[model samples]
Target: MIVVGAGPVGLTAALLLARRGHDVQVLERRTLPSELPRAVHLDAEAQRVLVDAGVDFAALSSPGAGLRLLDADHRVLAEFPREPGAAGMFHQPDLEEQLRAALARAGGQLTTGVGVVAVRPVRGGAQVVTDRSGDPVLAADLVLGCDGAGSTVARAVRPRYRELARPDRWYVVDLLAPAPLPVWPGVHQVCDPVRAATFMPVVGLRYRAEFRVTDQPLDLPAELARFGAQDCTVVREAEYEYGARVARRWRTGRVLLCGDAAHLTPPFIGQGLGLGLRDAHQLAWRVDAVLAGAHDALLDGFGRERAAHARALVRLAAFTGWLMTAGGVRAARVRSGLARLLPSTLLAAGTPPLRPGPWVRRPRVGRGHGVGRLVPDVRVRGRRLDDLLGPGWALLVCSTEVPDLPELPGGARARVLHRGALPDLGPALRDRWVLVRPDRVVAAVGPRAQR
Candidate 1:
């Protein structure tokens, strides 16, 4: 399989596929990690996806302060604290490095400094035409478009982008702070009529600031002066247009899009990279299954599932942008008041559970409530379920009676759970057997297998 763009999403998808014994090839146009400012807030869900992809995220990250809403004068409107063991600040470039290392360890090949000319379906599979000399035209059963917003694979399928909201432009500033500023550690969303800005603190004394563009030729030092962070070395400065958009279709034929190729969420919700990581998580499993002789429609189901999930978050981000950038003093006050009323859970990184479909079995009234949701961090004999889930379907038999051998998909071994074991699962698995897909999502919940 060929994966385009060696960014975190591409590398991650490549790694996951490689771990499942697939020969994955990654293509990247840039020789170096991107200098463009990227996502800093990685929720716990995204972190779990990375860990499953073989990345040690904790060592590479620092604890992050939670989200805060502030008025034009910088007075606190509300604070949504990070949940226990929730993610914090992280550097995108560092994550790329880790992904590259993990990909190499998993035997995935990454070719940098190569430009992809085009991606198209040719016969039974897809092909990636690149500018590389040794292997310019590579064809595989699958093609993944992870190249950012301007994806060639996406262009081959659906060229039009569905704009979810009015695009907003901002002057982005990245700096290396001389010292840690604990006083302003959390992400501060400044809702000002004059300037709708975002102030952020990163790990290792790095800082980022964004000011909504009002006029041309912005003064960097002057902008930083207002934030009391002018005495710092500037890293990169650029004008970035943030948008809420998703591809018309994530898949068309053998080629599939992941990450920014599939959708682009406004940074208001800090889900830009997190959403992409989720793509890597769900896509790898389906791709592996398809390669193992699963139906072509499986990939289609993946496209439908991810598109719906991504669109929901994109809408939320667009609404957040409107709430934080409403004009006028009276509008700002109204925004602050709304922020005060906003439930902390609304802004949390956790997402809505997957809707029922091919990948997620629709739950019955109450017995299969855990279906379509990611299994909790339940442990068996002190071993994490994460470690137990292999490259295939796993069964967590919660019902009584431990069958010597249970008939399941792939003839999987069923591990029966007794009361007091895996307390994290609690009553979710009280009287039903939970079938977990390779992605760690609960696929189905029903009675224990008798055979």
Candidate 2:
């Protein structure tokens, strides 16, 4: 398999594919990881991806308290507190370095400084033509374009995509904290109409602030001073424009797009990284199954499932951006009032549920709620639920006896849990069994186990 773009998403996909016994070569334009921070957040779902990919985050990340939306006067508008299994904040380079190491450890080939220039479909697969910058012509059974928004691979395969919205530009500043501040450990969305901004403390002694600014360049240090960050070391200062967009199609023959190559979202909701990682997670297993002789139709639903997810998140961020960065004082007031009335679950990160799809198979015996959602990790027999489930598909049975089930696409196991092991499983699994995918998504729920 040829995986384009060595960012987190691409590296992750390659690592997982290689782990599944496929040969993967990752191509990247940059020779090294970015010295400055890029993505600063990853929820538990992403943490799950990292664990599945064998990228350790214990040394790279810390828990975040979620987000706080505040008015221009620094008054709270809506606060989304981090739940028990919510996201974590980490340094992008640290996480990327770990991913690179894991890929190497998994025996996946990583070719840096080579950019994919063109992709052409061949007899049974696709050929990825690359720039002569590093590697040469590569042919593989599959091609995954995990490249960013300005994806050359995406353009080579398909020229057009739907632009969801016009971009909003913001100046981003990353500073090495000279010392700690008294601020809480979370993102502060300061909804100042004159200069809306976001501030957060990432892993390491790093602090980042992004401000909505005019096109004119300003003294970067002066801007940091305004944030009372003058004493800190400046890591990087640059302007970034973020908007909503999704490719008209994610798959063309054996070539497919993932991550920013498929969609782009404003940073308002902090889902940009999570969404991409989720893409890699959702696609890798299916690709492996197809390679292992499952029908190619197994992959037919990949683009649709991911496109809908990307659209939902982009729309959510767009709405959040309007409340925090755009609109007038009257709009802000109305938003504040609504925020007060909204439930914390609605406001919190990782609250949205994925809709049912071909991949998210649900049993017909019961309502089978939570079938499409990522299953929460719970303790089982003194070990983490995931640790007990191991890898691949798994069946968690609430009843005393484990039922015989048809073989899943990937091999699966049945683990009978103690009656009260998962209190949060709720009535969804009462007198039933839950089938979990390799990525730990609840694939199905039924009275008698089936796949």
Candidate 3:
């Protein structure tokens, strides 16, 4: 299989597919990822996905803490915790570089400076036209496009699918601050009627500022001046708008769309890359299954499942963007009133809880919940969740007394956690045995003796 685009989503897909024993190639148009910070927020769910993909989180630099919502004057509106198992912030390139390094270690090949111009479906495969050193054609059983919104794969297949376009244009200016701002180590959002600004700390003494400037092109110097900074260098600038759309068909014969090639949404909830990561994980497994001679239906399930998820994220992002960028006097009044009336708890409630255990359950042995479902990640004795299972079936026995069930087969691993002792277990599993799947959903809840 050949994957197009060497961005985070594409590189992750390549690594996973390669680990599943496929010969995968990742193509990138750029020589390397931008040094500038982009998409700094990484949520709890995304971190779990990275762990599941065998990424060494410890190898990368630690991310900044929590998320903060503020008003135009930087007055705190809401604050959310940023635990290791919860959401945090990191520079996009740093994370992407780590992913790329992992992909290289997993035997995935990356071809930089390769620009794919067209993709055409062929008999039982796909053909790609590209310009690396020169115009050349490459053939593969499947072509996975992870390119950004202006995807060459999307353009090539545009005539074969329906497209949705948004109405308003939004501009974003990314600036690098030489010194750290006198703020907490978290994300800050300043909402105003005419403009909005989001500040996220990427690393020590350096920060990323995302400005949502509408109506006119942003003057980087002028904008920086308004923020009390002098002579700041502009790193990146782009125009974007929120929209909800997906390829009518993910797989046309053998050519498929993944990541941004398949869908694009605003970063309101910071799910833009998160959803793409989900696509990589889900599609990698199904593609591997198909290659291993599993039912073709599994391959078809990719589009069916991901399309629904993509649409939901797009709508949610659009709604969130509307709330943050609301205009008019009435809108401003409503926004201010909301800021004054809404409790911090209510705002925090909007953020998902950190449920890590249910996420690691095996689907075949234990009941599988949908992706992003909350699950506990408690350890049994000295065995950590990362060690108990090896990408297969696992049983989590949380009981004071051993159950009467038969021993697990060679392919399955089991863990017995004494009641009221496992960390992060809370007071819920005091003396009950819970059966968990690899996907981390509780399959069965019963007395300890039931096993």
The prediction achieving the highest lDDT against the true structure is 1
TM-score of 2: 0.91
Ranking by lDDT: 1, 2, 3
lDDT of 3 by residue, 155-191 (tens): 6556243344354565566656666555577766666
* Every model's TM-score: 0.92, 0.91, 0.78
Evaluation by lDDT, superior candidate among 2 and 3: 2
Off by over 4 Å in 3: 58-64, 132-135, 155-168, 216-232, 340-374, 379-387, 393-451
The C-alpha lDDT values of all candidates are 0.79, 0.78, 0.64
lDDT (Cα, tens digit) per residue for candidate 1, span 325-390 = 766878976886788887776677477777788658765555666777788766677876677666
Better of 1 and 2 by lDDT: 1
1-451: candidate 2 lDDT, tens digit per residue: 8999988899999998988889999989999777768898877877888888887776788888878887877788878888855778888888888888898988999988887778987866888887784556788899999888888778656836777777888989888887886677888888776678788888768999898886455566665565567788878888888878877788877788899998899887788988898989989888988787777776767887878778887888787777567776776767678766655653463635566776576666557677888777776657667776666777776656666666666443445554445645655566567777887788777673333
Instruction: Give candidate 1's error at residue 290 in angstroms.
Output: 1.1
Candidate 3: residue 286 lDDT (0-100): 57
Clashing pairs in 1: 64-88
Best by TM-score: 1
Deviation from truth (RMSD, Å), model 3: 5.5
How many collisions between residues are there in candidate 2? Answer: 1
